[model samples]
Structure formats: C-alpha cells, structure tokens
Target: MAVTTETAETGLVVRYSFLWPREHDRGEREGRKDRPVCLVVPVNVAPGAVVVFPITTQDPLPGRIAVAVPETERRRLKLPGDRPCWIMLDEANGDVMPGSFHLVPFETHPLRYAYGRFSPAFMRVVLRTMAEAIRARQLRMVQRER
Candidate 1:
C-alpha cells in the first residue's frame, strides 16, 4: 500500500502487523498476519512515521488500557460484525512505513497496511481519552517522586 495525503489523518484505521506481548521473557512479538489499528497522530508531521493504536475485537479485560467502540460509531465506520471491537490504548505507539498507509490499498505491506478512517468527532474523542490517560500517568509519576 502507498501512503498518500488522502489516507493519512488522525483516527484513520488500517490493517498492519502489530506487536503483541509474549507470555514469558520471549520479548515482544508481532503476528505474521496484519491487524486493525487506529492512527493516533496527524499526517502532516512526517512522511512515513506516524503513531498508531491497535484495534481488537476481544472483550475488554481488567487492568488493560482500552476504549470500547460504540455500536453507533462502529456501524458508521463499517467495522467487522463478527464481534465487539476495542482500541487498545496500552498498545498505542506503533510506527509504519512511508508507503504502508492507505485507504484500502491494492496490496498490503507485511509490516503495514490500512483500510479506512474514523470520523472527525470520533477522532476527537480518541484524542481526549489519550490525553486523559497521559495526564493520569504523569500524575502517578509525580506522586511516586514525592
């Protein structure tokens, strides 16, 4: 897939090879297949580098950072109907290649790929949630320092 101006935007969703945690000390690992993800950064910053958040269909587990995809918004985005999907905030800072971002590209790259994007309103909510998470983390760090 080729990264273009049209496809690069905040809240854009794409299919890519996302890194997942291992059970033991095996280190982080990404599956051979591509998975859905959300673009958390604007496209104007860099050519190929952009921050992303992983999207999953698994139920939200305790202690895991995640945001549920509202059914209305899910329908608007036309996400898969197989099961409920959620954005994994804990897995947000992934990067992609310059030519890996796309809005339904012809060929998907092994390390990067994309399908579609989310609406502006949805993106705003995502950004707000992320900001709140960061603030909470900062507060914790400050408390620990005291």
Candidate 2:
C-alpha cells in the first residue's frame, strides 16, 4: 500500500532508520541501520510530523523505559524470531513522513510499506506508557531534518 500520511496511523509498524537521541547528541545525523519502529504519532497529529518509537530485541538497560511486546503481538508481527522484543518508550525519533528520507520500503518486499499494526488495546498500553515516560521527563526525542 502507498505510505501516505493518511495511511501512516498510530500503532503501524514500519521499518525505518531511527536516529537515536544519543546518536544525535554525539553529532550523528543518521541512523546506523533500518529497524522496526512503531508509529506513535501520525503526520495528521502535527502536519508532516510523525513520531516513531524504536523496537529492539535487546533488553532495556537499567533506568531505561520500555514496554515488552506480548506474545500475541509478536505472533501478529511474526518478528524477531523467538527472542522477546521491547518497544523503547523512553525516546522517539521525529521526522516528516511521506517525504521522509529515513522512511524506506523493505528491501525484500519493495511493494510493502509496513509489517503490521499493533492491536488497538496493545496500542493503548504503549501510548499510555509513553505518556508516562514523557511526563516523567524520561522521554528523549531526536528530530530528523528532511
């Protein structure tokens, strides 16, 4: 499907080059590699802007905020093999969609624009936890230009 702003909804999992906040802090302007990221705020929320939280198979280090992906959710995506994955809630990468340089189609499936979407109930849990992280001043943002 076409990855237009209208189709990029919250909970949608897309492969993206996510620039980490620490990387940005260190003067890096690009992400190291493409990885799965959940769309937390779609472009419609702030015209042209989208916020994506990173997904990783690695466990969260101490003091970091993250939410584990339930088995059902994992089954839905069929991702990360048998290893548990976590959606990092402590930070997000903000970029403009539809025209984002970092948002790319899967190399293995050029026509596909996304993996799948999280269930609405699970999405609510993600958003709520993210909001808490934001309120606690634990959330960091790396705004990507172009």
Candidate 3:
C-alpha cells in the first residue's frame, strides 16, 4: 500500500504528482487528453532514506526516470511547501525533449499494462540488458572521473 501525507494541495514537480495511481474510474473516465493525473498529499524526504526511482513506460528515453520533488516552484504553485512530486531526471543521459502524456505518466509498474504486454521472459532479458548497460556506463564514468 502507498502512504501519502495529508496536505491541502499537491504541488506539481516536473510534471508528476505525489498522490499517484489513483484508482480507475471508467464512468469518470476522461476523454483522450494529455496530462498526468494524481491527488494532492504531503511528502517527507527523511534523512538516511534511500530514494527509489520509479520507472517510466516510455523506453529509449534520453535519461533514467527517477521520482523527485519540487524545490524551486513549490511556493508559486500554492502547494504545501516543497511536496515530493514525482519527477524524471536524467543521470548519465541528458536533455530529454519534453512530450505530452496522454494519460498518467507511463510508470513502469505492470499492473497498468495493456491487455497484452511484453512476455515475462522478454522482461527478464530486457532487465538484464539494462543492468549491464548501467554497469558499463557507471564504470566509464568512474574512469573518466579518474
């Protein structure tokens, strides 16, 4: 279960939200549009917390997708200070051109997959390949730093 702090308004951070994955509502289903849907909630970035990066549905992005909060524009949005809104930041990859989100942000969680998505075996292979790629890039970055 996901835990969200009680906040009057949810601050938008990099086009993502804090209270996310709100249950589906077909009757309330919206027509095709471009926007990320989520609720408002409080976020606590405690010390010693290892931030977990959420994956995106879109692949071959310019960078890795990580959950981040708003630091600069929280006050302007009239949200509860700096809420922990989800954000996609490129680590090794840089400068992903912005695009429209038809619905919610394509988070990597599989529950919301299409009726027939990629097979399990394929998923394993893809994950392995990604792991290797990340390792190689990290090593290259270390070498460059040295």
Candidate 4:
C-alpha cells in the first residue's frame, strides 16, 4: 500500500484511524496518548467504486473538525446536496498522543494518496513491536543513568 504518512500530520493520522465504530480498547483506555495525534478515516465505497475520503483536522480534546472532501471523490460523496456523513476521531494509542491535523478530502486535498485496508490484527502486532522499540529506547536512558 505504501501509505506515506506526512511528518506534519502524524497525530491527525492516528485520529483518522480511531474513527471506526469501536472493535477494540477499554473505557479508560480510549482517550490517552503520548503526544499529538493524526486521524485515520474509513470510507464505505461500493464495489468497483472509489472510496471518497474527507480530510479533516482537530485537536486533542478534539472539539473542532474541518473537513475537505477529496476533489477526486467530491462528485461521488456530493450527490445532489447529499454530502457524506460527518464523523469524529477516536483516541487509541495512549502511549502516543494525537496532533492537530488539517484534513483535506482525497479528491481536493493536494496531498491526497491512496491505498487499501487497515488490519487491526496487523496494527496490534505492530503495536507490540512499537512497545519493544520503546523499551529499547528506554534501555539507553537506563544505561545513561547507571
């Protein structure tokens, strides 16, 4: 899929990721993270149809959302004044904080990119790998302290 996540929009990217209707995470485990977050959004496209994504931006407490539908999918989601539904991002990674993201729809957003599928199982594995990376990073600090 080779999704090139922007350096500036990382936190918001995570925000997009959390938008799904809850298959994981606990009550207290949902909204905490290490830093700023990026949102990951999922669009429902009919088979053989392109999924149009509206890129949006938000803050940690996640109050405001500015969405710009992708120019490519603009015509798709925008059918006779019937634009796509609006959704807010959910916070998942408590260790990593979410950032304020400026979302532009896949059609209009200049930085638009494409790909396929987010495997929650794969994400979970990657998370475990991330935990190891964190531990290794901490080990260096421990050695310095020693």
TM-score of 2: 0.92
Write candidate 1's Cα lDDT for 1-146 as tens digits.
34555665677777655545331125433344456778765446555566667688888688766778877767776666667789876554445445542223335355334556777877777787777767666211100000
How many collisions between residues are there in candidate 4? Answer: 38
Task: Tell me which of candidates 2 and 3 scores higher on TM-score.
Answer: 2
The local lDDT score (0 to 100) that residue 68 gets in candidate 2 is: 97
Candidate 3 residue 76 Cα shift, in angstroms, is 43
Output the lDDT of residue 14, model 2: 86
- Write the residue-wise lDDT of candidate 4 on 1-146 in tens digits: 11343322221231222222132322332222221122222235222111112233222234322223334343433322334322222222222111223222254554433223323443344344334544554211100000
* Residue 97 error, candidate 3, Å: 24
| Candidate 1 weakest lDDT stretch, 10 residues | 137-146
lDDT of 2 at 45: 56
Highest TM-score against the true fold, candidate: 2
Off by over 4 Å in 4: 1-104, 109-117, 138-146
C-alpha-based local distance difference test score of model 1:
0.59
Candidate 2 segments exceeding 4 Å error: 42-45
Tell me the lDDT of candidate 3. Answer: 0.27
Instruction: Give the alpha carbon lDDT tens digit for every residue of 9-78 in model 3.
Output: 2221222221112211222222233323222121364321211112233333454433332333223333
Worst 10 residues of 2 by lDDT: 40-49
What does candidate 2's lDDT look like per residue over 9-111, in tens digits? 7888888899999889999998997888998665345776778899999999999999999989988887657889999999899877678788768777886
